[model samples]
Target: MTGSTVGGQLAEELQEIRERSGLSLAALASRTPYSKSSWERYLNGKKPVPRQAVDALCALTGTSAGRLLALWELADAEWSGRARPVSAPKEPQVPDRPAPSPAPPTAAARAGVRWWTVAAAVAGVTAACLAVLAFVGGSPDEQARTATEPPVRNHGCRADTCEGKSAVAMGCGAAGMITTLATHTASDGRRLELRHAKLCHAVWVRATGLMPGDRVELSLPAGRTQSVTAEGSLDAGRYLATPMASGDSRTSTRICLDVPDRHPECFTG
Candidate 1:
């Protein structure tokens, strides 16, 4: 198999594990040495993920790394120019999945290492993403629940003092602080959350994920509002926040989004 093929398989396994854990990519990165950007690339198959990174994810979620290790070994071999012909442990059981590329000419090179390792983990690792109704697939029917963030640390600023300052930097909206007062998602899939730190008497807008042209805003009772626009690719897939505001955002304040090609949408908790 080609490196890209193996990398893609590994990526899928990682993404599934991530989703099941109910932790956002940001959370995964925060708990591990890897940066959010690194997780983005690793999960998206844009770069070669380190073998040890899997260990870190397993550590955070309390999952055994055995199965993921199998996929990684296959990916590592391809990246290192060592390709094998055998299907990933029982991959033959599901002849229905489409492959990314054709296999190599022969399966002769170091067969022992790949087979032994693959057999140990392949039994249950890939079946969720690739078999029959239950053999190699997962339940996709359940609606995806919003991933909650941890509480924001004490920002030590409230009301007037927090106005016009980054809620995250001030340690307010960056963390869940409290559970989301309200949440909204644009038709195009950009997400928004109203986060509050009651002790600080502050509330802010946290757009969990944004695109190039997305805009985020939070408003207070007296026509006060703060907004920021998404900039470049670096900003893409990143969390963006608005300055802090006061009052019961659950009812009084309005949170809105201006996304490309869609009508502006607003929500209040």
Candidate 2:
């Protein structure tokens, strides 16, 4: 099938799964990392569905991702056709100089002009050499400082500590330190913890008292967010956000559960 046809088929399948799962657009958005408008575009084929979004939908509906991914590969291949070769820059044409004076100039005047021209050429060359030296040498202290600096230390638990441990348990929370930034309870009485680790410099939310298929979403200021769904009758789930810098005062964190008729709970860091 053509790439567009394959993409259309993929979109149709995604919509079918969502409908079969009996979740509204808002509910899907609440349970997944994507926004409602993004879901709309993906379903209608107005935009390319991201791989992560595809995986999330498959997980939510208990559908296998293999077929969807194959369609995506075809669509992506069509979207990214062979790159066109770049053309080389055209060379500049030098304008012809006026012919030398029909009558020869005086010897003294010619000598003076030649001297000035040589001086200007030397000055230009010297300036270029100085610029190169400045770039290559920098400041001695700056060079020494860089040379003597130690390698950056890796954060979070390593070796046995991380074995069989959940991401949060291994000190991979926001900022790389397992600090609880806030807590909230969902309308359904599930407890949630907003965690930050200094080393990872990212935020995540953990929800407890969940049931099968329950989902949790954590949104942070500046449009960072994550979502995860419960599996296998588990009572807990966690959603992790992208990495961020530590100690930003401008952003707030929010958490929401996909339970019906519930609003998001928010806290400022």
Candidate 3:
């Protein structure tokens, strides 16, 4: 695919994620190291999104980052296409100067002198070229590729490597994290989910509209469980996360949210 097409598609996805996240470019800039103008260019397809920016946006939105990072890989490959050779620069022409006056000489002498002049000119040009090559150290095409090459991506770990960790923080969300497997909405409008981080071989709980004293939990077989409590009221749209636990689709995983004075609500996936 063309770089523009790939970049535009990635940009559209990022813009959608940003809008859903309710974070402004300035917020994104502040949250990450990127500048506001950089985020603007990234969302507008004026440039390819770097791996760091993609991961940062996904973490900010509490969204799975795998799909976006995959899209970014494609865009970067297109943008950093094969480098072309840099053509030699043409030397500027100088007006011919009058030949210096010389005494008349034999025909053989004139030929030898002319041959010597040509040899010296060739040697001078060759030496100058060697000096340039020594200074440059590498081909222009190599330098161009180095300049435009994409940054290395670390997609986080898989399976055991991701067990009991924050998917967003460890970059699992940027790779093999999956969509919500099960969802539950509480009587008070709080929402909970059993999320499958497939690459992580684990599951976790995420809840929104949490109130102070709200407790969220993710449980697996053999009594392994992890939970989190809201210390204070949280924004309705902000998600509260629990530490992950080892589990997969083959096994049932349950997520629950318990509010004070209310019965615990739970769902299994």
Q: Which candidate tops lDDT?
A: 3
Candidate 1, position 48, lDDT: 68
Model 3 vs. true fold: TM: 0.44
Q: Write the per-residue lDDT of candidate 2 for residues 19-133, one digit (tens) a residue.
A: 8989888987655546789789988887767655776677657576677878776665444431234343333464887757887568998778767766777677768867875
Q: Give the residue spans of candidate 2 off by over 4 A.
A: 1-4, 82-269
Clashing pairs in 1: 127-136, 131-136, 151-177, 152-177, 250-269, 251-269
Q: Give each model's clash number.
A: 6, 14, 0
Candidate 1 per-residue C-alpha lDDT over 1-269 given as tens digits, one digit per residue, 9 for 90 to 100: 22349788888778788899898977865555467897888888887676557755665565656678787876766655446454555423436566566864256544665677677676665563455536534442211111111233535467777677555434444334555688887766788888777766777777867888888877777788988788877678866777667644454787778888978788875
Q: Please give each candidate's TM-score.
A: 0.42, 0.33, 0.44
TM-score, candidate 2, is 0.33
Candidate 3 lDDT by residue in tens digits, 1-269: 22358778998888999998899988776555467898899898887677767876876687777678788776766676532343344434648876566755689987787677667777777798678868988754455445654333343455665556665545444433466787888777888877776656767787888887888888888888888888754333567788667777777777777888988888777
Off by over 4 Å in 1: 1-154, 173-176, 249-251
lDDT of 2: 0.58
Model 3 spans with C-alpha error above 4 angstroms: 1-153, 234-237
Ranked by lDDT, the better of candidates 2 and 3 is 3
